[model samples]
Target chain A: MGITDETLKRRLDGFRKRMRDKEIDMALLVEPDNQYYVSGFRAISYSRPIICLVYLNSLQFILPELEKDHASQSARTDELYVYHEIACHRGKDTQFHRPLEHLLDRQPASSTIGVEVDTLPAALYCMLHERNFIVKDMGPDLMEMRMKKDQEEIHWIKQAGVLSDLALESSLHHVQPGISELELDSFGDKKLLEAASQQFPDQLIGFADWTCSGITRSFMPHLASSTRKLEKNDVVVHSRQVWVNHYRAENERTFLIGRPSNEQKYCLELAIEAQAQAMQVVKPGVCAKDIDLAAYHVFEKHGYGEHVQHRTGHGLGLTEHEEPYLRFDNELQLEEGMVYTIEPGIYVPGVGGFRHSDTVIVTNNGFESVTQYPRSLEDMIL
Target chain B: MGITDETLKRRLDGFRKRMRDKEIDMALLVEPDNQYYVSGFRAISYSRPIICLVYLNSLQFILPELEKDHASQSARTDELYVYHEIACHRGKDTQFHRPLEHLLDRQPASSTIGVEVDTLPAALYCMLHERNFIVKDMGPDLMEMRMKKDQEEIHWIKQAGVLSDLALESSLHHVQPGISELELDSFGDKKLLEAASQQFPDQLIGFADWTCSGITRSFMPHLASSTRKLEKNDVVVHSRQVWVNHYRAENERTFLIGRPSNEQKYCLELAIEAQAQAMQVVKPGVCAKDIDLAAYHVFEKHGYGEHVQHRTGHGLGLTEHEEPYLRFDNELQLEEGMVYTIEPGIYVPGVGGFRHSDTVIVTNNGFESVTQYPRSLEDMIL
Candidate 1:
């Protein structure tokens, strides 16, 4: 659980460089991603705010009293401040601002503190100003620093990829007729946990809510699960992606419930082929859109162009979805260690759709496919 | 899903009355909760920014092209506008400012727009002035408008409670040794999908990750699933609640894996009795902290006050953890129709912990308990 001191020092150097380029004294990270990136301390709370004070030389954390033990054990901080409600002894009405106020009181006076203006509340900004910290808004400078994945991140993502493949492998056996889509989804969830039980010890979102387009799957993303039970010749879709430390990896596959029709088989074949075609061009220095085009042209040649909804795929790393998406309009230049998904799907209303995607990492020469699931239509039968 | 015009008109009237008191016009709501509260659109793609352009007489929505169809279908708006990313394709990544800029351009010139300053980003605020709209920071005017739930909101929340209970009921049967905590948590997730299907699809921090106590359990409020095998004497805690359309129905239960020791039974009994005692005093005009003290006093009487760590609970209408917490410092007087959770726990470190909590609605006389799970320790069996 402890990151090497080298990793810590390198990130501080990166942040220091970014802050200097942006002409800021200190970067105040409020968003969960920035906090995790800088301090290596991730609170278990989903949406509860954690204020991370990062100066060039040192770092500090202010956490709720309940989470003090957690922060002390997890966060790489020079100092830790704990705040509690103290309501058990005091009968007077007090606002929930005491802990934050106490932190502000101790802040360096008139310091040019660069805040994540988007995440910091106006009230908190006012509170800081009242305490003599001149808050300056630092834009996406810190986020841009996180755009590229390092060695450890790439390793963790590779581990996540192995876990995703295991999930797909386990769930494939349960994709028979009479089983609900949710049951299939939960089955995949079970598989993901089984794979990561040792690595993460406690990992959630291993198998997230699965979205399927049984009959009307022509290019629509984010389909809600339906009560329509799997039947003979039903086209089934399942995605097993894990989100950890604000990073995400999504890999999807389409299957036949019992016996698929010729059209369904053709669609699945073309989709898989297109994704493979996209995978061939994912080398360092290639434009992200060209790889997207590599897949889009295949789908267009097969007359499924209009039906191919959604982008080819998205960058698969921190934040289930982030910058450098695989789309026609995206101008991002793919770099080594950049990980992304190349999913090409075709949906037709009331009929069904076919999708095949995998997470891939760009290598020096070409790329490495993180997903090892079978892509052939004949191989994906219940 | 369509609300009556009378109800809409009444809320609008109340909003106007509050606006007049604050001396602001054209309240601009960008946060999802406030947007849903005013415009009634539940967003799917959290990628696109959706804003509620509320004026004196009517409300309008500004959304990205991909969200137009879904947002238009659900949003209670008189007008809708869609912005693009330089092309006709949907969900294409452009700067998020493009759509936000377009919305400000369409607004009437020289009108005072009340911005939710706490939620609106500074970059977005800079964009507003560039588009000729005069922006004024409005404090808690919109929050005050949403604090009191209407009859319809109460109905939806109660339905959420029923669905949450069904999930807990289905999940309890799967609680046994050998199954990883993630699998146990997945049972609750599957049950939730079965109960409300689409209406209640979001995650309620329960299950999947925090099912078993190990290293993760030590990190209180763990949202991820643990790999720890449920042993004969282990205690499993579920802290996740159910959230439907942002309205929260908080509930938690601790289950005994197989046989329980005398201290374990004592912990469970104390937590339930304390929660019951707190629930007994909920009604109109009681300060929120008094209920917290009721639970605190019981734990103190049992000489387990130090172990009864976390705050009693908090207001649970929107966001699983919201404002007006049942803590020692809160002095907000409870009103009828206000719903919140009263979760009190006794943690014994590596020895495991016990908690019994439920969502309660303050009625005219006493209160209506929304969570119907059995509070008895004997009911939870392997």
Candidate 2:
């Protein structure tokens, strides 16, 4: 099942309370995840703009005509204003701006409007400014609200994590010296899709994977899976994120293929230790920085401090990387129901990058890991 | 091979010329495709802001610490300023805006800056505005440049088209009753990845597929593939896009699973005719509206004018949908080397959606079809 109507109602009520506190007459949401949180509608692509407007009492959607039926079925909204592209509908709303302008005209000229400052387009912001409307950033409010996952969201994320582990197992089982990175990812894709189909009929599921192999490619963290064949003794960083009903879980593992170097084994073990340390610090009321620092100290103690490049981990939910990051600078307190990935990594120049990522949920006192894939150095060697 | 250095130089020179003509001191590119076109660099994920600044004589990148090595190897830039998240790197450029501000401080207060108004975040735009600098839109300039594919770009797009066709054929081969939509997509994915790995070694290849099976889901044009099993007499619209080295080609086919209704067959044939009519009108110097209208007339003559919801097609290249769309209101003239997807579809309330998409390249006089998947009613009947 998708998100419950009761959960959606509670979320909308909370957002309206926030808007009232800020004395905002309207909140224009352009970020897809934020919109999906309030209204249960999402499109595969957003090359054509889709707007969600929330007021004190009701919500509205301004989308393309192509999404009319889909939004009507999924979105719990008060009104939908569709803009058409077909010639026969020329006399109607042909452009999104036309309907948007009409909606704005209905509101008071001096009304305060809230917008996602980080995602709202400059052109739209300029239009609101030129119209003499008071605009404030509601992006932070939405981020703060979405940081804590509800029970329904957690359920899907847990399912995604379980599915991810299965997919990772299938991919590793097919790992060999001659297989290309893309082919390696494909093996997992087939297993994940087939398993998801069998288990969760009628549910929407999606995934993204990145396999960076060899010393040169794996040293850089974020590279797409390519057609380069994996060589003997190559260190490969395989990252997979699976989303069930839009909630995501990230799972990553660094494995050694025919490795002979003692340094490579040491680095992989260090990464596993760092990830464990970070996961150990995940508890309610703990500072986000503490987790990062805990993992950082592991690498620093091993004389690999400079090799650490990114944060320990990032929050995972509707989007790939959400707010409340486990970074050294972040001081946000961990709360119950908050979900994040415990992934701390180090990349050495001549050696290879090593990291193990697992999704975990913060419970009343401690944290519970959703992904249970084997990540020990012995298990990682292929 | 990836993008050649000569192509990068030519693209940069063209963009700089546009900036010089506008008297803009610098152009800040935030869109991933635009950045890739100019700098030949792209990150797998951009949750952390990646800013590319192009000046009259030089190019600079301000990115997260994780992307330092990746960007260095790929981006053709003069300088790289990285912002860190780890605590040890504090007091250095800790946030993206800090480095961005440092770069801005070097320019004169009255210096003009160019930005992608359609995609630049409102917060960034406000920051630029508060700095007492004049900002102009360079998004259109980038779109205009990207509209006409270069020879090297076309080569990759062709490769993408070939891969897309092969993938579609694989999916269609596995189409049968009781198979889930996602399972259908996975079959194609497996075939595509294996073939791409064999054919294009050491290259980057990616794909996205959406299979909207049955009446209700098919009525909506854009929906992610689900785990809903196909039933007898189901109407399925299978859409796939394959990208090689960042260039994309879209391929789609609407097929019948078992014994479809006569109305379904007629609708499918009408969609095929509409697409053919639109593709036939794709010549240099022709207006974009003419192609859309040519497709629209096919449905109108067949008494399904009101059923059309979206435009005939959209430009396809680095982005899924780009400028110079095939819409009735858009009167932009088509040019040689322009690539577009000719997909003219109609969705009936009680029936289903019918559309066949093919990527085509505008030639000196006519057009060349890149995605040549079979579209006949007989060929589509599974």
RMSD of each: 4.1, 0.9
lDDT tens readout by residue for model 2, A1-382: 5667999999999999999999999999999999999999988655789999998988999999899888889999899999888887889988789999999999998999999999999999998998899999999999899999998999999999999999999999999999999999998999999999999999999999999999999999999999999999999999998999999999999999985489999999999999988888889999999999999999999899999999998888998888779999888999999998889999998997999999999999899999999989999999
Docking class of 2: high
Q: Specify the highest-TM-score model's number.
A: 2
lDDT of 1 at B80: 75
Q: Which lDDT values do the candidates have, in the order given?
A: 0.69, 0.93
B242 Cα displacement, candidate 1 (Å): 3.1
Q: Can you give the DockQ of every candidate in the order shown? A: 0.33, 0.88
Worst 10 residues of 2 chain A by lDDT: A40-49
* B1-382 per-residue lDDT for model 1 (tens digits): 4345677677777777776666666777777766766666756554456777777777887765545555656677888766543222546435556655665666677767788776786556656655666667654666566666788878767877887787888778777766677666667777775555444333222222245443236336444455555666677787556655456676678877667777777877888889988998798999998999999889888888877657788776755555557887678898887878888777776556677778888888889988898878678545
Candidate whose DockQ is highest = 2
Error of 1 at B177 (Å): 4.0
Per-model TM values vs. the true structure: 0.86, 0.99
Point out the worst 10-residue segment of candidate 2 chain B by lDDT.
B39-48
